[model samples]
Target chain A: MAQTNLLSPPSTISPPTALQLSQKAPRIIANPPTSSLPWPLSLLFSAETPEAWVTHENALYACLRTHDDAAARQLLDRLSARFGESNERIITLRGIYEEATAKNNGELEVVFKKYEDILKQDPTNFGVRKRRVAVLKSLGRTSDAITALTMLVESSPTDLEAWAELGEMYAKVGEWARAIWCAEEVLLVMPNSWSAHAHLATLHYLSTQSSPHLAPLNLSLKNFARSIELNDSYLRGYYGLKLVCQKLIPLLSESSSVSKRNQDEDGPPPNLETVKKLEELATSKLAEIVRRYQPGTKEWQGYDGAEVIAARELLNRDANTER
Target chain B: MTLLQTAPKKQTLAQIRQQRSLVRGINLRTNANTLSPSSFQARKAYMVSAYQEGKFLADPEGRGKPRPNPMSDPAAMEGMMGMMKGNMAMMVPQTLIMGWINAFFSGFVIMKLPFPLTPQFKSMLQSGVGTRDLDVRWVSSLSWYFLTLFGLQPVYNFILGSNNAANQVTQQMGQVNPGAGLMGPEQDPDKLFLNEAENLEVLEHRWILDGVEDRLLARTAG
Candidate 1:
């Protein structure tokens, strides 16, 4: 959890302002407690690096993570002050603050009502609209959230973030086809995004898993390969390919035993030799990445934490079985 | 500088898109006689056009015709001097008054500056004033003139517009970087579009998604 990017290595005092140096003053660090400082006083003590306005959201999220309501409230207050109370961004941040700090569902519903009122007054407020979807999801109204997101995408189809969110929402409710469609729409907007290709592959894999009979694995494998081809540094694409190939090797070895085999007399599109080649390709690529970028190194640190761990585990499993 | 080397031209996003459509049209026309669905589908004209057009926008300055040197031409030099007159106007007035005031005042009043200066500066600044001793650390009115000359940037900016004459640093910088002015000149859009169109013919598209699904299932179910 990137609670706050402002936190530095402890010995390296970040900015080393007056408060951070003195022993007598209550200095703030990475994660401050809920009631550590009063809203007005906290501003003087806590120092986030002056980044672009968007990074303030990271700070706000960080405050929420630590359950530091006073700091979160102060941060939101600062944002609202900077970009007036009537600003769409301020309204969304306020909603997020309310949602985060709320003790019960009643409070959440109240926040939901606030969003609805804001949206009703000015419908083009997309920031508030997105926040409303989040609130709806939080309120356990998935269908409503889906409808809202669908409407959002229809109006602004090129909004890649909205498409990605819609994809996840669809996947959550077990609507694989629609999820795939969402992925496709995202691709339509940004065809060259390697992450999008990897994500589409994952959706295809999930689609196959959801079906009673096996869907074509070719699409999934091809997407994974395409993702890797587009971006050589794509760790997720390699990891997905490795996992798919591991599952695939067994299916190819025992194709007769599987009920839903391909009916083409061309006797499988890739054939057995090609599957082994891909399996080797994934394994070698993954091994090279794991070997080259050792854990805690800058290169390794660029990879996702879970993906790195998963890749390490996969390699270890292979090593153990070989032994 | 290398006469043997050839650099590709750079085109904008709009130029690239226009070239792609033109190439698509060319592909359709060239193979009009052999326009079977199967033969037509063999080459994805759109994809081939898209990834190639404007692949090299702003590649290198030297293509064929040598770039013009402003200093070599007398007319261009005079035009530049004319343009520079406004910037010099504010600086000239301030510099003249400040120098005169400094020369008049420092003849008698040998004032100590708020900050200390090195011994070397004392010779330069305290040239006409009193202090032949170690007390040469004192600053003359000449030092103040130098300080105000550079430091009055914010004051001038507040008085006149921001892009006004007080800031010589910014003005000199704008001079060094060509085409930094608001209404300097624009690149030829027609030339850029045509360059991009020429680049499109030799480009090829490799579709990674083609037969991908089939390959994945073939491996698994085999």
Candidate 2:
């Protein structure tokens, strides 16, 4: 159990405030702001020893861990100022994280520019690239995110995560075939990738456009089931399996009825109406799975939990209309 | 042979399960480092907490990772032994009461003191005589008939059980299996055992239980 300290902050125990510490700092080498600095140099301060820098890093990490936004913001401010405005990529990224979560669009735009600058300087920083992808996706720049991720995938085929991200971006943009292809690519690299299988299943089961996709849907469900076989706690794979199963149920029902007639009938032509209904039902079920595992109220903090709940509601509305 | 040397001790199932749980947790944290920053942070915090709690030794700047040895830290070994001793001490009261109760119910009696007695005295006297006469005689007969049962039995069992538990903990450590717990069903028993063997060199150095630790480990293998 965590011990809670109820005492007041210690009085008269003054740690050097930022201004006092900065006064003892060395002069900055007057270089153009656009020039790329060694990544670590961008983290320097006037009199701060490596030990103090480490302590600051540890403090920032602790704030992030405990979900203390205010402390995290203060640390980010200090780091950004020390590194100078143009080169504080990490600090700027932290700012973006803070702003994105807070839904401060103006703040998000400011920090996003910094991220863009970081990417321009070194596009291969996979960590920054992934975070940038998330920011872009959240900001509704789906096309741009996809282009960036596509480039990332071309360069790093071994990174299944990049493939997964591309697959998700494709889905957001309604490029179902590309999404399926990306998901499949991930499974090729990591045969037991539950997320990839889940994405593929979602695309096939939820899309109403074609019949060729159903084969991959079955395959995706099987992969998902295999992932579940490996780790039962994988709620994502379970949600995917549930969506596929919901879709399969109606198709199976239609087939069983047709089989009784003993007639060579091409399966009931895709009824757009029924297909749309199945899509809504599958989507709703996926949301319900997420909601059941959603962490409680105070800990909610604008998480996947809310997105999951909203997605479920959207599916329910669609399903209700179809019914 | 002495009581401790008489039989090769075995690891109990509960000890195995507990160790597996801890090892599995450590593995989950290790593997989480690859996919998520949150997991990396959590693992770092967990390590820090374990160090603070004295469950693990402090990590020096560059002198290799601190391996937990049950034997090297005399204080830790003493603490575990102390717990076993405390548990053994508890058995004394349990046995004494159980022995007295068994004797009373078995229709044994001391010399009947035939004098008119108060009801209170009668009950108290009956209990005392029952314990002394019935228990003492029954125990004497039992010692001759079933010679193996002794006071040291509980103590030895506690020692072996605790040692087995500690060994299992060493097996489930984070350094041993980095991603074991996240997907429990996928965990490899053979791999876990192999890792445990590799860790044993360090584990043995911290042997918490004097002679019984290895003996119990061998029995557990069986």
Candidate 3:
């Protein structure tokens, strides 16, 4: 796969990529923007492309992550100069800058207070509200974050990001049921997302560890199967599927002779033969993924390095047990 | 005629701005990363309950109040004025050209059609020329103007890229009739949501991964 570009922000930024992007900041910031004169006069000067602004914004983020506050501040000044300080997006960016530069909890709390004041002035500023929630989360106030997120979602039921964040917070606090509900809410909005299926499956698997219930395990198995079905190449889905099937196989074999009374409301448990086959399939798939996704390979460079290593270790452990 | 055509262009730009504000008000772009799915039967069940509870109409500001009509806003009125000014700008040059053509090129054949035409087209193709026996293939200057008026669409598209406002035919057809768009102000969003929910209810959920394992195994074996 081609390396990701810095002009458009990526969902997750690794430390090395952040460093690389921040190193380009001074060069990007050195170029002065085109003079924003009236239309005909503006045309006489060199025109600034929208991509330049996007690059400036992304460079600021990268600088913030790499702790290059000077470069970040310069980029921020340029942005505010162009768009004005009162622009809602610029306000959010400024809030993020303050949060990043805060040295202690007291300074962070002051930043949080600023967000609160911004929200009080314009309650409709969802960006500042989200920042406030983030500040709460960073302050180790999980319950308060959950409360704020719940209010956010109640007002905007279709806000899938808030729902996902709420689910993660619930999972953090071991509120498995609420986390599952939050995941289901996300599923309601986006019906074709394979990653959501894998996420819900992972939540179920985690819940199963705490409660040791056959119901969650079965749901986890079906969801993992559904996720892999949606996206055949999803490594996380395959890994979860293999792990769940391995756990289910032994349990199913042990309970083979037990007389059935009440059927599970979720679904019937997997058959022993099917579970064993799924385990074997998962094992083979994981082995293939690990082999094909070798380091420095051009074709399969998309898989995360850590995930491939984990899959290889799982395969090795399985071989050792079998031997 | 120009006013009638280009009015909708300005309206569309204003509509886009309004929609962007609405999207930003709910933080849609910043929170767009999550994904989800469910079986149709289950989704239908959820939608039904959700609709009954009025979840679709939930206000993001947490106030249970309906929003004002976007078309009636002052911004839309300003857009209407801007569109009028644009139409006026286009009309002056158009009128000047028409007068210039009438003064200099009336009653003259400007060009000929490549293919033969029936005598029925003689009046249309030789509009300004009064000669009754003139071949229908010989196009008058006025007729040529009309042809270019309708036919310069591809030329405009070539020079200005696809979505330029200079195309007259598209401008004529693309008039934004109030309450005619997908999310028009006059349409009740509650009804639209209910209709969509009903449609989703009947949708059959087919799992695409049904025989995926077999397919994967076959590919690997081969």
Candidate 4:
């Protein structure tokens, strides 16, 4: 009227429809209310929305940070119903399930079964097999443990950890040959693996003692030396080598003496250098054994440990005699 | 025109060698006896008795009972004594010979006897009898079994004191080979304290299957 033109009065503009209002409408209905969720749905729906999903995620995270598993699970469940079991929800739920099982206060088999079902469906999802293998080992199903480890080794042959695990499983079952093979496989992958050499050395020593041959002894000695070379702190391998050398050296010394006595018509004692090398090996290995496994603490207690004590006693006597 | 006394031909080395050959056959027979199972058991029993029990057999029953002295047969005894005295005389030192000669010359004569002073020495030489002393045999057998279990068979084998490992090694020789064997899982000492350690809750109501109690805690706290 003032303009008298009625210029269509700016033609009464209509507000945009709800669907046309925000592209984040789906994000709004799915979020829960928590301290972590700082934004209201109405605010989230407004034109000036400041990251609704992130704000809600932070709120839920804060509740979990406070050790509120119930509140956390509640929010997670509510979100899962809306969002379905996403990877994040699966992981968090699995953590809660494992914690419950570990406490012995909950039904473990049922939860583990559920976890297995999930893993069966996904298969390559995360490190589920490793976790399952660990759980099986804890349950004392050694055969099953071995089978699981076999599968892991087959699937992940290049995985050093998997190789170690397979070796350990074989060792636990008294499959020395297989254990040594697995350990050597690991050594192939990780050339300087002290543990692998230790495993091989132990197998050689135990399995060879009943035989008339020296090949087993030689191989065992080599692996023991290799293990010591890799890690001098591995007292078990060092002492084990010493124990073997203790038995072998006397036999070799006797053989050498016999050879020397027989050599009146010969050029030289048969492989005299071999005897010298064995003696040198024994000396060094015994030294390593003493350095690594000295008996102040009860660390050396059982037969193997007691052998270390015996070695020390013998060495001390030798030193005294030398003085 | 004296009756021709034929010069006794000196026994040549070949004839002496022939005579020595007879003793080798006796040695072979003794060696065969030593290889018998009873001989092995006797040796093992002896070793165990000597080393572990601090006992030695003065007269083991398995050994045959000794005969009474051959010296009781004076003709045979005199012949044996003459042989011994003749051998002793040649090898004996002059000073030792004089002492012996003086002793023999005097009334305190040291006469050589055909039989040994040790009674039934040959009879005591018989190897193990199948059955005799129950307690001694039982203890020996029991100790042998236990020591094998404790891995003493190797030491016994090395000393050539026992034959138990013989059959065992032969039986396993086909399958036995060298390599590291599987080891049993090493139990961590820390595992013993696991039950004693208080459970540290990473999340509560994790025990509650349904979120009902977890929600309740929140509601109660709120």
Candidate 5:
């Protein structure tokens, strides 16, 4: 548990894990391995390691998630003291702390105003800019958040995080074409990212519902297959591959003529045999993942519990339809 | 050697920060203008042509060619100055030591080899000793000094780990052309961006999932 605590915090944490980490925060903050002796003695005696700072940072985030505001404040104070107030990262952390502790929309507005002030003084502070966008999003002004994000991406095109966020925002607002473009942009920057390919595949699959074309389904199938090829053990990739193959198998058989007409333009759609084989591959992979993940096995513990459960549900749904 | 080591380490840290800021600035300028749909389409056309031609077109404004001397850049200038200072520090001591050995210990036969040596080594092993008939195995003091000069590398490696900048020979060679690795001063940022764009365009997406069904079946059966 102590070893895990020093690692960087994951983007999303389950409520139970969040609570457990938050419960440990006060102890971590109180007994930081820093020495209190004078400079010379402290340098010689302190048991401080770089991991202690990482643990503190993770503890701070966990405390914020669990609404342990006091513990979060203590960790924030220690961090600011160690890495002065003017440090860019500390400034962003302070903004996050203020955003968390604010009880009302008006207070959030105050925090938002503070972030804007910081940006005005130094427009290059991308960390604070991201925080300001987060504030805009939380205030139920998603369109405004999207505009801000668009400008942010315009300035820093290489920021994969900003591009991914822009994609999510476009998806949230039902701008499927723009969302797909953003996902493609991510792939252009980081072509080997399995998650980016899966995201694009999901977007293609979702868009096909509105415009029932075999082209989008074919595109989705190719992307999902690409994602699975990139990461053999990727649960999300296999799940998406399975879903796309299931949809394409029936479509390919029924609309053989339609597929032939578009073959020259979109490349040939996978034959029924290939589609069936891909479906079987996805099914076997998903089953293996679900079996190994259910017991919280040591090697499989890295997979998120929620994702594994969702994969299990998908497998069960497939079985029921077959029956 | 310690003096030589300190200069490069400090300059490298500063160079990294400088490079990051330079890259971020370039990214902002290039991305800000080309993100619109029409411009993006234009870039795609350019990329496709560049891919077919197997080379990106040079900047029409003549910005990418005939790179200026890297010494003109203030950071490179500073690094070169630091290197010169380190080289001078090293040279002074080496020259003084050579002069002292030549003056005080020139003709002294310092040591002898345990094993026999051929007469061919007499000139090499008895440099400052002005005796043509001297035993080939007897090393002059000047020769001994030269030997220790080159042979102390392993001692330095033992004292400070392998990566220490204590090897005089390698350091002199490195100083001949500073900042010659990736992100070298001579590289034009625009050309690098274009080259990367071309690479991305030419990259073929071969799906690895083609025969995964057979592999899966085989695994299960085995």
Candidate 6:
């Protein structure tokens, strides 16, 4: 799996049973045809499992997914009865229920308006604001969604989650510099996070690739090295560092061979020797990571499946280049 | 400040939960408010003095020594509890619940139910219909009273906010633990004031716009 995953990456690993059960709509509602036993009876049996409420909650969405209108309605009724119909979560769930039942996107607009009305009544409602954002995104009004998200982050600056979301939105719009800025904000709050450092590095690498003349190359190399220094096992950090070094070694040579490029305080202008040494360091470290956490092992599974796969691909490409 | 508005969003379920926690973090009393240099220093002065005053009231000795605080006395504690229970929350619902409690025990059945149920139920769940010839489906007035008592919470929340009178579950939990809330009546104002004072004293304001001009100039030059 590791060897072949070089050029073509594998999809997300099937979540372990406990996670899958929590994430998926429960089968009880999703597959009424397959289950011979009645839902209440199934509930009675599973009541002791401590996962019943989660199952029931997921079952509500499951029913919607399967288009089991009756089951979905029943689940919603049960939920609303437990937590009053006017409850914010219940209200949003009702909107979601309607959205699911809507035949077309046009019908979903009415549900969207309902959420807007709810927000207009209580503007501070984070729950409603979140629902409104989702509705806007689903409706393909990316700009409107961005507006709402910007407000959310404004009121809640410490929210790393919102920071990440705003970052992704910028990335989607090809606003690479903006995305990098968002990453830096999160990095400011979470200074010691190796992954956050690596993530910022990735953003810099991407921005430079997209617009080399505009992006800050110095931060790109520094951050990736920082990530690796923070957590040597971080495969993505090493992978990104290698790529940045690969690009820099030639650029440094060209600039130096022509004329001494003006160096800034951020770092001595990436010289050929430093770039080559960093590239070698990245390659060896990546190779060690691949050898230690070969795919299909428990230890390997602990590493981000996608990052490991991508690193494998980079190594393979580098090997081919050498050949 | 400038670059933040243009960024990111997957807006997943976990992200929403995270946002809630982060938002909660800002409201903590220990946190210093975002302020300009002058405003921050002024607020710090105000906070320390206010805290000292509160702390002195709770402990007359202030930080010097301990004293027999009246708040800890049984009579004062009882009075505080009475005030909390007698708070505005009791005005409408308390009268209603009291009236119904009397009505149910008075042996006067106001109404019956439309549905059927088993016989051997608690009086709270059964009808208060005053008669021996009662059907099992007849709901006791006491039960109806409870139904309204617990049921109107969501209605209250809809009319108000979620934290308003509608959620008796939270209210009841709050009742179960009196001193759990910030600055509950039994608290030492002195300690609270001192904490706030210290928090304010150490509060350093970093202006977001500090290096804005330089940053923009560098960007333009580059």
Residue ranges of candidate 5 with Cα displaced over 4 Å: A1-3, A264-266, A288-303, A319-323, B1-43, B46-187, B190-222
| Model 6: TM-score, first chain | 0.75
**Chain A TM-score, prediction 3:** 0.94
Score residue A24 of candidate 6 by CA lDDT.
45
User: How do the candidates score on chain B by TM-score?
Assistant: 0.44, 0.24, 0.59, 0.13, 0.60, 0.38
Q: Could you report the DockQ of all the candidates, in the order they appear?
A: 0.06, 0.01, 0.12, 0.00, 0.10, 0.04
Give each model's clash number.
Answer: 10, 6, 2, 10, 0, 18
Q: What value of lDDT does candidate 2 attain over all alpha carbons?
A: 0.47
Candidate 3 displacement at residue B100 in angstroms: 6.7
Give fnat for candidate 6. 0.02
Clashing pairs in 3: A190-B36, A191-B37
Worst 10 residues of 4 chain A by lDDT: A1-10
lDDT of 3 by residue, A82-108 (tens): 889988889999999999999999999
Best by TM-score: 3
lDDT string, candidate 5, B1-222, tens digits: 344454333333223333432343334334422132332454456544643442322333544468767768686787677666656755787799999999999899978899998998887788988897878889999999888978877776555434454454466676544334535666764555555555545443333333444454355446
TM-score of each: 0.52, 0.35, 0.75, 0.35, 0.68, 0.53
Candidate 1 colliding pairs:
A217-B217, A218-B212, A218-B213, A218-B216, A218-B217, A219-B213, A252-B222, B10-B57, B10-B58, B11-B57
CA shift of A235, model 5, Å: 2.8
RMSD of 5: 7.6
Q: What is the lDDT of residue A303 in candidate 5?
A: 77
Candidate 3, residue A133: CA error in Å? 2.0
Residue-level lDDT tens digits of model 2 in B1-222:
122121222223232333433443343333331221222344345434443333321122312334346677665577557446545554576588568655654443434444554444444334333343232222223232223334444454444433333233233343233333532323433344334334322221221112221232234235
The reply for model 3, stretches above 4 Å from the true place, is: A33-47, A257-259, A292-296, B1-46, B53-180, B193-222
